[model samples]
Target: MHFSSETRRDDGVVERDFTIGEIPGVLWTPEAAPTPVPLVLLGHPGGLRTMRPRLAARARSATRDGLAAATIELPGSGERPRGAKVDAVRAELRQALQTGEPVTPEIVDRLVLPLVEQAVPEWQTCLDALLELPEIGGPVGLSGGVISIGVRLAVVEPRIAAAVLFAGSFVPRVVLEEARRVTVPVHVLLQWDDEGNDRQVALDLFDALGSPEKSLYANLGGHTGVPAFAGEEAARFLARHLR
Candidate 1:
């Protein structure tokens, strides 16, 4: 188990990478003045396009107000290459065994829904590494399309304290039906005029959430900017809950 850390930024965004467990993640902290900060873990969208600068910038901007954010590439994307991704993920299981920590997957069938099933295990693995980081001693929040639908399903565990979802369409009905069981506070951010399935999907889940603290926001933008919205809102939300 080796760990690597680095920082990068153009303009006001600051990006850093932490390699823990078998997965190496690019953690983004805003370049603003240092402050004791909350940790926000961002789940990138599935497919090649999700691993891009725009999403990184979104996560970085959230830290501007005083928060620590990081994004880990799932098995086959970002800096985590496909060949070694699975072995890296399995390494997490071995590490968990050594630490006596529990690691579980929310979604199991990614072929049908690349968002939840394919990436949920990766999310769980990333969370495990994050909890061990010196700078990340706070509640965790998650947001992503299809890939992050597992966040709500992950409610059986208490480690995750908060979450914000943006245009997720993985298990619309199941997630909505089970939304109330999630004890953690959640927020759904979306585009009011979305012309795709995500709009309706997020809306339905938002309606089903039993948590009084949960709410939904339909932004002016469309799908592409959802991560940006989640990043910004997550900062505020984390400050209130984790800080």
Candidate 2:
């Protein structure tokens, strides 16, 4: 859906607009509440994409669970216009490849990493905006497409209550080890398929997690299907924890 000017549910949850750096975001919450409601910030996967259905489903579920939920259209998604700068980056990557020269780590770090870095602060700034709401609580939960990097960014802010990582991968072992410092609970959902990462390996890795309340849920299908389970489990988990 195109961004609304201001939207509200019959139950009194209001949807408001926010801007994180250059990125645009939206937050939803009940108009009347005794305290700040718990929140879940839904994040999109790597591709240039939008998952409005998934986000809407989560928002509805969170509303029922006495929590607030917000969905952000990441840097490249939604109505925001992309500029010539991005084209230049792509052109450089193309030129390097066309010349048969190896793409060095420095090139990737300098060019590609900045785009991803730009996205991280938008998520954090969205969380910052959500926290500003009168009905939102101190800690928030996240379910993102890029789990490893997402977790790194989320943990930077201690206010995050927990995180539900959906089929996340590409975790640096050093970073994964350091993630144990995150005090909040994390529920990692994984899919078992030859096309996907080895589900068992991912499960075992999370099973060894240092967080006190870490858990794992495994099922059939690819990256997208496992979130169906995360959707159900997230509702229950939020009720038990956030409530």
Candidate 3:
């Protein structure tokens, strides 16, 4: 909950760097909002520093839409300590990717399970801290990836009113099972041609989601080539729920 720096962007979004214990995070709010505003929790695949520009852009979009946005670094990513064991698993996954080796279920289990277990609680903790701020007092919505962590949060975090999930990440089968417990409205964005993602897994996971209001948006592109209209639709989805 301690902010290290604050900067007001040209577009009138106020950005702040913060830390809750060991987890580093960022929060963005409308520069002139007077009342409490809805909050959007921006999730990413980790590496907060590397991801900040894109994260901030999303935050600015939220603020422009009269919502607040925030994100925390996931376990074993960014500046936090990952220890030897987690580092070893990360190394294994990277090596497999570089060699064009199929990422086995075992390797995915090793790489993703620990992250879902640890990051979900950290997000909840960050939410607890962010809500204490006077400027952010409305409903919470989670928007972004890793899809596994988003699924867990949608299931367990009662405070989250909605979620906008980006498909095409390493989702373990266990998480797909957990998705059935998620009853809140969910909008999933799937990139049909993402080179690094498994299309079948994304489709299966989308089908596994138990939300009666869920919608899957499959676009033709690589990981970073999401069409602009796709993002606008996801924003609209959040606006509908949080409002």
Top candidate, metric lDDT? 3
lDDT of each: 0.59, 0.65, 0.90
lDDT of 1 by residue, 5-119 (tens): 4556555655665565656667766555454356676655543244657656556555664667766666555555564545555466467557866433322222223434545
Off by over 4 Å in 3: none
Q: Model 3 over residues 73-129: C-alpha lDDT tens digits? A: 988888888768778988999999999999988888888898899999999999999
What's the lDDT of the predicted structure labeled candidate 3?
0.90
RMSD of each: 9.7, 5.0, 1.3
Which candidate leads the pack in TM-score?
3
Model 2 CA deviation exceeding 4 Å by range: 1-4, 10-12, 46-49, 78-116, 172-174, 194-201, 204-208, 227-230
Clashing residue pairs in candidate 1 (N, C-alpha, C atoms within 3 angstroms): 16-27, 115-146, 115-147
The predicted structure with the larger TM-score, 1 or 3, is: 3
User: What is the full ranking by TM-score, best candidate first?
Assistant: 3, 2, 1
* TM-score of each model, paired residue for residue: 0.69, 0.74, 0.96
- Sorted on lDDT, best first, the list reads 3, 2, 1
Please identify which of the two predictions, 1 or 2, would achieve the higher TM-score against the true structure.
2
